[model samples]
Target: MKQLVIAEKPSVASDLARVLHAKEKKKHYYEGKSTIVTWGYGHLLTLKMPEDYKKEWKTWSMDTLPMLPKQFLIQPLPKTKGQLQAIRQLCQRKDIKEVVIATDAGREGELVARWILQYVRYKGPVKRLWISSQTDKAIKEGFAHLKPAKMYDDLFYSAQARSEADWLIGLNVSRALTIQYGDQLSAGRVQTPTLALVRKREKEIESFRPKEQFTVELSYQGHPLTSRKPLVFSKKETAEKVKAQLQKETAVVKEKKVKVKKQWAPLLYDLTELQQVANQRYGFSAKKTLNLVQSLYEHHKIVSYPRTDSKYLPTDLESSMKERLQAVAKEFSLSGTILQKGKVQQRKVFNDQKVSDHYGLIPTEVAPNISRLSQDEWKIYQLITKRFLNLFYPPYEAEEQTFVILLGDQNFQLKQEKVLEQGWKEKEEGVSSLHLSLNQELPIQIKVVSSMTKPKSRLTEGQLLAQMEKHHLGTPATRAEIIEKLVNIQYLERQGREFIVTPKGKQLLTLVNESLVRPELTEEWELHLQKIEKGKEKKEQFIQKMKKEATRLVTEIKQSEKEYKDFALTTKKCPECSGRLREKKTKQGVFYVCSNPECHYKRRKDLKVSNHRCPQCHKKMVIVEGEKGAYFKCQSCSLTEKIPDKKAKKQKMTKQEERRLMKKYSEKAPAENPFASALENFQVQD
Candidate 1:
């Protein structure tokens, strides 16, 4: 009898097959002397929808507001049904003696494999191969020590509980809001609270009032020194008076204090921290950062897992510290600086207790193709590599000098900081990190700086991520998607790095049940989910609480007296429902949606790409309708082309022009068609 192995994706299955010596490849499975390897396309199965349980639940009505099933059912996803059938056929092969689950080692990954197992009713000897990082060495070690499949039952249960709760709460609330408001609106467990954070920041910005404020700056030994105390004046006249008095007077040094400080480098990059840092530095979206790092892990096999929440490595991982360092040292050229130091200090960053599903993002023994990597990918990889090197280096040291100075009647305070040692911070070696100066009060320079009290800035993706992690809104792997969903649905938009709540987003928070808007309720459910994972609580109990919440939310919506006014109401009417159309705006373009809930009518904005090229820049133009009819306009060069009409006078070209056109068109003359055509005869303006 042979052993059958299942992996999450085809690439992973190929990796497993290569190592298992399964060389013969069939359409679906790899065949070898005693092993077979098959794969899934992410997830082959998903929980069924409401109508799957009962036909009456298909329509959007208040009677079926809460369509809770006694027991949720699993159905094969339509797109991957063929793959599911293929895996099922392999499970029953007579030669297969035992099965191994080689899916990703996480809560959702466990669910992906377990659901298929339940669907096919695979009742045989089962084992699991779990490992972090996709390196060949890690795969070999993981297979050599496969664990029992039953050991991860709790993880599957937790994942299923989370999924079911979302369906119950999100579907019911979204349906209720859509029905009550008579517009297409959405709400959810994690997304609802996350949207509320954006609205909260937006409200603060809207209500803020800015006023002129003034502060005095003084020059001490040519370096500008600001007062440490609250010396800000509400009036410009008051600040000017202080500045004028301090210009001619010299300050008296009342006290001098000095202290040496040691600062350690930041901890390693968890997925959230890495996303935040990338967004702040390179303006990378959370999803973009995740994708770049994921490619570095699975495609290049250079970094460890990217979805980890832990910033510390496991104690056992400390043994391979040198190999990881050497892998990254190839591109960074810091081997001498890192090697001359002693062995890894093995400080707080190397604790088993702090490590989660996987250790912190770090390099592997496999060297990355530095030259082949895209610029964005290199930026992400560089961040991970340098962070790992910080573990072996020493702490940064600096000295601080602070003193009090008396300037006439007003007391002023000044301070200076200078680096004493550039220990792990090699990036700061050439820059001005060290500059010491003695305190003196010989000369004085004063300038009054006037500024306005500004409102708090909008929330950026990084700030929202930190808020999500703090409130337990979503896990490290799902937070990026949660943010992206709001933007996709037009609830939020991005301006640079800041998040701006759209008009629709503000109404969404106002229309949802009050409890759903607060993060505390979702945080409580997350805690319950954790308890379920540890076997302290049952998945069924947590799900029952969710059902009750869903029912209550639906009932509240049905009875609420609040009315919704469409901020997007347009004069144009929807042809299907005859209701006033609401003009909705999104990143894609403007859209007109019917205000009637039962009407599923939507028209995309009337703008289309055209094959016509701009005469100046040779770039494709857009087709837009104007008062004079349809015309072609180029976005690149701001050139306009009046679309030819049947009434326009026509001219014919010579045989030479026609022959030239044929060759030019065949040679890919431009991104679109050139101004002159090769056609035997074509229309042209007189």
Candidate 2:
């Protein structure tokens, strides 16, 4: 009997097809003597929307909220219905007696395949192909020892529970708040708490009051010494007095301590850590880094799975270290050095217990062709490659020196660090050793430095990801997208590198229930989800808990006396209806919307009149800004031209010239206008 294999995406299906020798390509699948391989476009089936279950749920109303469906329904995504049908047909093929689930080896991946199977009513015996990397050897080994699909039932349950819980909580709470507030507000089990974190940080920054303080710094034999107490005096008079005392006295070394210290290399890159580093180093958004790393893993076939949370390799993978090192030796010089050193030992880097679903992101046996990669992909690949090579290197060893100096009644401390061995830090410069004579008195110069206690800095995307990981607010695969979603919904705005909570975001925090906005609640839910995955907690129990929680939250929002005021008032009036326009932010950037919700008139705020004239209309073109860049758009004849740079030089117009030009345009009526015929043609088409 022929076996059918299903993959997560087209790229993976192609890799599996080549390795399985499935050369006979069909419309939607590849066929061979013993196997037929097909693929899904991420997810072919998704959880049904609220309206799909009932007619009353179609409109956003408080009465219809707390949408606790007895049995959540799954429907084929409208966009991918054709592909879903193809997969369903492949599953029902008379020759295919068994199906192999070869989608991603993670919780979400399990959900993607299981949903498709359930939708198609596929009941054939099934096996699972679980492998981290897409390399030929890995795929072959994975298929050689496929496990029963039943083995991953708990994982699938956990995935379903998380999805349903999110839908119930997010949709119900979001609808309740929006209905009450009369604005488009959203809250999720994880996203609300994550938003709370940003708001909390912003509040801290806003309420912070800086304090003026002073510290006395002393220099003796080119070594800087800090006060023994490390005290910050609120009064400059007190600091001046201490400085005078330190200046008059002769400093003596009371004690000296020196010890060798060893610093180990950093652990390998999990998706979160890699995203954090990329954001900090390259100013890449978390989502941008994820896309780049995913490309390196799926397209280049160089990096292993990119959505992993573990920062360690499996113990079993150690046997193939030599092969992996040799594969990358040509691209990386350190790989050759590591290969020459023979088998290197680092237990921390390879632990089976630490690995879950997939090992840490490391280079596969496939050597990357750097020339074929985009600049971002190459940078991410280099990051993973360097981290892998660093594992085999020695720990950074150094000598740390601490000296205690006595000046009158006060004692001062001085520190110096000297490198004993560069080790893993060979590429970085080492600190120089300090020479200090013990039990000797020396003349020292004292200076009082004025300083102030600054408030905490705003959270960058990197810092936000780290906080989310620490709190278990979201999984590695979803954290970046969550942040991006918050930005898209206008709850958070980006200012340079930092995330600023908008006025609407602060209002959202105030309106939502305190318990729902706490990270601890989301963390607890995540813990329970993990339990469901491990079979320690039943999926029904989690779902019941979520239902009850959703009910309570909806009731709280419904009965709340809190008021929400629209803070997005703008001076511009809507063209469709003579109503005041309000500023609204969406994924496509900021735009102005009519205050009258029924009118539904919106225009981009980025549009500005440019000096460049439309070739067809011969009128000034308006500059339209977008995510990528800006372009010139003519409203008269609907002509568009790309602006070379967003900051195109503006045409200067003197007051007299502007008045004269305005007068010339004002004198011409609509019927007599030069572009009137072209405008009429556009209107007729519309």
Candidate 3:
């Protein structure tokens, strides 16, 4: 009897198959001497919806404000029905005596595979293949030390608790909010808290008061320098007084201080972190980057775990770094660089303690074709590839320097520095890290001819984002999406890429309680989750507390008439039914819809891609939801394809031009008919 190994996705399954020498492919499974490898598309099963359990809860009504079931139900998604049936059949097959769970190493991944096993009622002995990257070496090693599936019972339980809690709180809260507000408002643990952060930031930006400041500057020893402390002057008289004092005074150097600092390379790029960086740098959406990374992992089979949260590899992975690095160097054309410059390998990218479920995203040994990927895919791929290469290089070294010029009483000080050695910086060659190392002490010879005290500019959104990233509130993966949501919901607006909160955003914070939307809430939860992962806290007790808190929050919302309408706008009438069109919140973004049930017309503010035209019915396609993301279906021809955002498509078309083209193409006229012939006939004889 052969052992069957199932993975979360085809790429991983194929990698395992190759490592196991399962070259003989049959249907979805790869058959080897002693193993058979197969894969699932993310998940083959999921929790049943409210209506699935009971049909009465389908309609939105205040009476069903807090619909809580005694026990949750599990069911296969409609699309995964066939896959589930196949997996069940495979489980019962006599030849497949043992099963292996080769899914992701995270809580969610554990839940995904375990739930299916429970639903199928597979009684066979189970094994778990926990590997970070799909590199051949990693896969071979993972197979050598596959652990018993029962070892992850606690992790599975934790994953289930999270899912159930989200359902309990999300469903109840969503229903209550929607029924009370008479809008299609849905809330969840992740999405709601994320929204709250955006709303809070918006409030701070709106209420922020800018204070004008004045400072004195002086020229000494041919180098201009300003006062280290900025003097905030409430009145122009104070500014004039300070300016007059420094006008005739020669600057004195109080003391000269110089310090040398050593900087290490940044941690490896995880999926979310990579997504955030690409979004901030190239204006690619979070969803866009996710899709690109998925392609890099699946279609290209060139990147490891794209949905991972960890930026560091585990201890087990460290032993294989040389082989992994060598593979990457060969594939990415960096062998010469590595040989000439030597490795800058550091502990930052390979620490075992930092990893929770899986290590950072890295490309598999499988080579990536640069030509096959789209422009956005190439951009994201380059980011991952470059970071991977840089991780193997040496640490960055720089000598920082400080200079202080003394003349009379007034003091002047300045600093400058240069790289002592490229070190790890040379791995990605000239690629710059997020933050440049800056401090006093290490000094470089500088010939400064001019310097002046100028008005300090307001912080850019990029700078704020960089600061937030350093603090680690949201992962690299979710930051872009969070920012985009704020802008979409009118919580923030773009002044070139800089984010500033709007009035609506500010008002949203006041409408919601501070406890529900503060950064500290997320920080607290993160701390607890980390503790739970380390087995320092009990999952059941933590979940019980969450349930209590959720219950309390629900009760409070029901009693208070906090007036959410104060933030929601109702300025325009619905075009379809002449009813007041109110602001309705959704995961996609905000929308304006008809209040009347009879006339259903709504316009989404968020962007969606155009679908293919129906060949039979000659109508534009509609966006269809898929397991992974959204897709497009042609209503006329029944043609279906994955839908990517138009913004990421790198297309240029004005609204008028798009509408004209759509109308022309969607017309009832046959393709054979020539518009030129008709125009010629209508023209004058001359």
lDDT, each prediction: 0.85, 0.87, 0.66
lDDT of 2 at 191: 88
Steric clash count of candidate 1: 0
For residue 622, model 2's alpha carbon misses the true position, in angstroms, by 2.6
* Superior by TM-score: candidate 1 or candidate 2: 2
Residue-wise C-alpha lDDT for candidate 1, range 1-686, written one tens digit per residue: 89899898998889889989999999988989989999999889999998899999898888887989999999999999888888899998888899999888888888989998899989999999988899999988998999998888888899999999999999999988987887789999999999998888888999999999998877666565556576589998999887787776767776667899987877889999999999999999999999999889888889898889899988787778767777767687765756555257538888888886788898888988878799999999999988888778778887777766777766665666677887787644332332334345546677888899999989999999999999999898899999999999889889989999888888888888999999999999998988888789999999999999999999998988887877888888888779888887766678787877678887666567889888899889998766677789998877888888766848678899999989887884433444345452465869
Clashes in predicted model 3: 17
Clashing pairs in 1: none
- Model 1 / residue 295 / CA error / Å: 0.7
Who wins the TM-score comparison?
Answer: 2
Q: What is the full ranking by TM-score, best candidate first? A: 2, 1, 3
Q: Write down the lDDT that model 1 would get.
A: 0.85
- RMSD versus native structure for model 3: 11.6
Error of 1 at 496 (Å): 2.0
